[model samples]
Target: MDTTLRHGPFVMQLGSMPVQNILVDKEWNIKQFIEVQSICSLPIELMLPPSWITGKDIDKLLSTEDDRLQICYRQFAHTLRHEEAKRPLLPNGRLHSDTLIDGLHSSKFWLLQALQSSGNPLHTFRRVKGYGDNYAGKGKPLAAAAFRPQIYDYLKYKIASYVDYRKDVQKLFNGEYGRVYDEEDLDYIRRRPIVPERK
Candidate 1:
């Protein structure tokens, strides 16, 4: 409820709002999409309250040091920037408002191909445990059904540790995104104070 931080001309943060209200907000949703991709497949029902999550929930996943969520976001935004460095255009010549997790692997594979073909060394990301055992049909662990997105997280942390992520964030929120945000809004997000982790 603190209105001290300026987001655009207005001051705001992820204060207590209906979880759905925040989730469906195009700007917030697209920010998540550009970062995690298909990692979230929860239905619209689950995306709402009673089972809703908040910035705190997200913060739970990040605890690298003092400023985990901010660092995580920095990494995520930068990773997208790396992808943009390779393929500057979305397939449709427009930025997707909602990038469902579909074709996620194919996208990574091709991006890997493009980078490797261009002389980037074979970057072997560490393997993450699967979320379930649907893929464990041959007596494998149910965990094989899914894998943790630690690779992406680690990559984000590693890269952010080395390079500046604010520029990447600006590029994502300010660059060619289709009307989801303007320079001011992007600037607001970039400059918004990092919320402290709940004790």
Candidate 2:
């Protein structure tokens, strides 16, 4: 859409495509993966389009100035980056692609485990066959059936905020991360207390 913006180059082609076309396709794939992971890794109650918060979303309950919400947002974004950095590596030593279905399954499995260990009752939820099933299911829908609605909304907002922040950073820096936001700001975000007081 915005051809004026600079983008990083990718050498490989999907098939019969030129270098520019491949670059465009790669960029789109990256954005799609980010969006899918943003939705899939979160509780199912928060995965619906109606539950998603975007820059254009207006909500009376979600306030931009809320300190508690801001803390959660920062913590979530920091933790997401941390987890992504530690994703499983391929036999060739390259990090596994986030778009891969097996990788998605592994991510959800560990995510559920972490939630359970933290006293979350997410594991009680039944997993349902989701999109890309193709008669034989490759993955199950990530669900958190009994998770609190208000807390679910809060978590959804944090995820949406992080996704938006990442898109902005990637767009502004031409695929480079950690440049738009200063290192001190990132450190502050990462250093915030993991458990904030609920008020």
Candidate 3:
């Protein structure tokens, strides 16, 4: 039997929900939600494993051209800095520990490496708990939640790209039939116009 799954923007071969829903909650605005979704649903072609033949593979990946992942790291760093700045003071109103800042920088480097080598953000970000926690209470420590100048901006930028990507993909597959008669016909079917005229 053939089945079709409908989402706000894109469809996949499988009937299960796309992973994006797990990342963004329903309360998020449509644009914010879809942007996260697009990043989550990026095609494999856009992701290529870097050659990890030497010292600190993660560092090498972040230094390379993949701007999308770079933005994510930048956001992560900004989040860390903001949180560190807000740490409970040592009576003199100064931060108690530099640990969080160090961790953020370190994690950013590793995350880039892991993503490049593994093509899995979860794997790359396993050490950092802020992205999302898989386990209920056994997750890694999260950076403190403090407002940073760049964190919101980077997040907004990434989310915007994600939204645009989702919109484009959804528009690309809006009104196609649920099932294809033949597997070989997919290319032709995808090329067919699926966008509906605005009413």
Each candidate structure's TM-score, on Cα atoms with residue i matched to residue i, is 0.17, 0.18, 0.21
Give the lDDT ranking, best first: 3, 2, 1
Task: Decide which is better by TM-score, 1 or 3.
Answer: 3
The 10 consecutive residues of candidate 1 with the worst lDDT sum are: 43-52
Scanning candidate 3 in windows of ten residues, the lowest lDDT window is: 1-10
What Cα-based lDDT does every candidate model obtain? 0.34, 0.35, 0.41
Tell me the tens digit of each residue's lDDT in model 2 across 65-144. Answer: 33443344445444544665776222333322322223223333223332343233232122212311221232422333
Q: Model 1 segments beyond 4 Å from truth? A: 1-56, 59-66, 89-199
> For each predicted model, how many residue pairs clash, with residues at least 3 apart or on different chains?
7, 0, 3
For model 3, the stretches where C-alpha displacement exceeds 4 angstroms are 1-64, 88-108, 111-199
Q: Write the per-residue lDDT of candidate 3 for residues 24-108, one digit (tens) a residue.
A: 4477444332233223442211222222312234433443444555455445545545765766322344332333234344453
Model 1 local distance difference test score: 0.34
Compose the digit string of candidate 1's lDDT tens values, residues 6-28: 22122122223334343345454
